[model samples]
Target: MKLLIGNRNYSSWSMRPWLVLAHFEIPFEDEVLLLSGDGWRETLAARSPTGKVPVLIDGALVVPETIAIIEYLADLYPDKPIWPADLQQRALARAASAEMHSAFLGLRGHAPMNLRANHAGKVSADAVGQDLHRVETLWGQLLARSGGPFLFGAFTAADAMFAPLATRIRTYGLPVSDTSTAYVEAIYGLPAFQEWLALALKEPWIVDDDEIDVIQGRVARGTLA
Candidate 1:
């Protein structure tokens, strides 16, 4: 399997499945496309129908969308516990993954992930607040039920799904409960996540569109403490 992704620093969509593959000890070669290039759109359109980052190419099959990639990889490696082993837990994990895939637009728009930049920021819009609250409740419930350092007690696909959001919370210093903070730290400490972060910090590429969101808020990213 060959995974095609965008920049390590700014591409959250690319980060999800990459982490999953890495954590599971999956043997796959990854190709990185520097985003925001002059021909970036053309590059994506040639491979992906949606013209997006993180396209998985397995043999002749092309898989777009992070959730789809996860599903494909999980099915291919049923021996591996991609999702939870338990039926009920697997269902909840899938639900959580789907929710993470579609929800949180406001948080995403206002708090773009930039591993290199450390700034405290806040979103003034009510929609962002609603998303934030949803995250707190959603995460709090999952953690309480699982009794976990991870959403499902172990690092499953559900953990991969929310990994970027964990980065976003830390990147923007978003207000989250102690439970959520602990969950973020658990993800941060994962060997795969640490590897990803180390690679992200070394990248010199910059996307102006992603970086410009930082100026929209005056809140300090990590200085509020």
Candidate 2:
């Protein structure tokens, strides 16, 4: 199996299934395409159906979209348990992951994912506040139900889905309660996340326009606190 990913420092979509694969200790070759280059476009167009990053290529199958890739991995490695075993828990996890894939436009647009950049305490707009509220509410509910650490008491696909959101929370210093803060801390402390950050730090590809705005002191040296 092979996974095609985008810039390690900026590609949130690439991070999702990559993290899932990492968590399961799946061994697969990776092809990293630096974004903003014609080479990236050509590579994606030649390989992926949607011309996007984070496409999974198996023996004779191609999986696009982060969730689909995750589900495919889960199916292939049921013993690895990409999702919770309980039917209800699994359903909730799927719902949460899907919600993340579709909703939170305000936060997504205002605070794009840049793992190497740090823009702590930078609130974008009024709508951002509402988005944060919704996220925190969901986080609080999940944590309350599962009781600690990860969203489902152990690392699962839902947590992987929201990992980028956790990055955004830390990057923008979004308003979050103590419980939500703990959840974010749990995510950042994961071994897979640590490895991802280490690789991102070493990456040389820098998209100048994607650099977090410094005029408002939102980003400091491309990393958040």
Candidate 3:
């Protein structure tokens, strides 16, 4: 199996599956397509039908989307227990992951992921507030149900799905409750997340638009206070 990812500094979508693969100690070849210049487009086009980063190629199989890649991994390695053991818990985890995959457009658009940025005081759209509220509600519900350290008592697919959101919340200094804040901290402190951050800090390829956005005060930085 081979996993194709994008530039570590700016590709939140790419981080999702990469983190999962890393966390589970999956041994696979990595192909990083730097998301600048012309190389990424050509490489992506050849590898993915959707021409996106974070495509997982397993011999004859090609999984393009991050969620699909995660699902594929879960199916292939059920012993790893990426999802919860309980049927109801597994269902809820899937629902949360799906929600994260499809919704939260407002937050995603307003505050693009930039791990190195430190803009301390920026605000996003009204819809972003709505998205945050929904996220907090979901977090509270899941944590209440499973009593985390993680979304489902242990790090599962649901946690992987929302990991980037935790990064976004931190990057933009978005408001979150005590429970949500703790959850974000837990995610940030994960070994996989720390590894990703370390790689991101060393990366040379910076998206100029994202850098400009950070400098221009379009995106807030630092963790939620």
lDDT of 3 by residue, 1-225 (tens): 998888887888888888889889888878788776657678778877898888999999988999999999999998998889999999999999999999998877777788987643564546489999999999999899878999999888789889888988888788789999999999999899999999998886767555535445655543112
Better of 2 and 3 by lDDT: 2
| Each model's backbone clash number | 4, 6, 1
> Against the unseen true structure, what C-alpha lDDT does each candidate score?
0.86, 0.86, 0.84
lDDT of 1 by residue, 58-106 (tens): 8989888999999999999999999999999899999999899898998
Instruction: Measure candidate 2: CA RMSD.
Output: 3.4
lDDT for model 3, on a 0 to 1 scale? 0.84
* Residue pairs that clash (backbone atoms under 3 angstroms), model 2: 116-222, 117-222, 117-223, 118-223, 118-224, 119-218
**TM-score of every prediction relative to native:** 0.91, 0.91, 0.91
* Quality of model 1 by C-alpha lDDT: 0.86
Arranged by TM-score with the best first, the candidates are 1, 2, 3
Q: For residues 89-153, could you state the per-residue lDDT of candidate 2 as single tens digits?
A: 99999999999999998877778887877677555647488888988999899999999799999
Q: How high is the lDDT of residue 87 in model 2?
A: 99
Deviation in Å, model 2, residue 76 alpha carbon: 0.5
Task: Tell me which residue pairs clash in candidate 1.
Answer: 119-221, 120-219, 120-220, 120-221
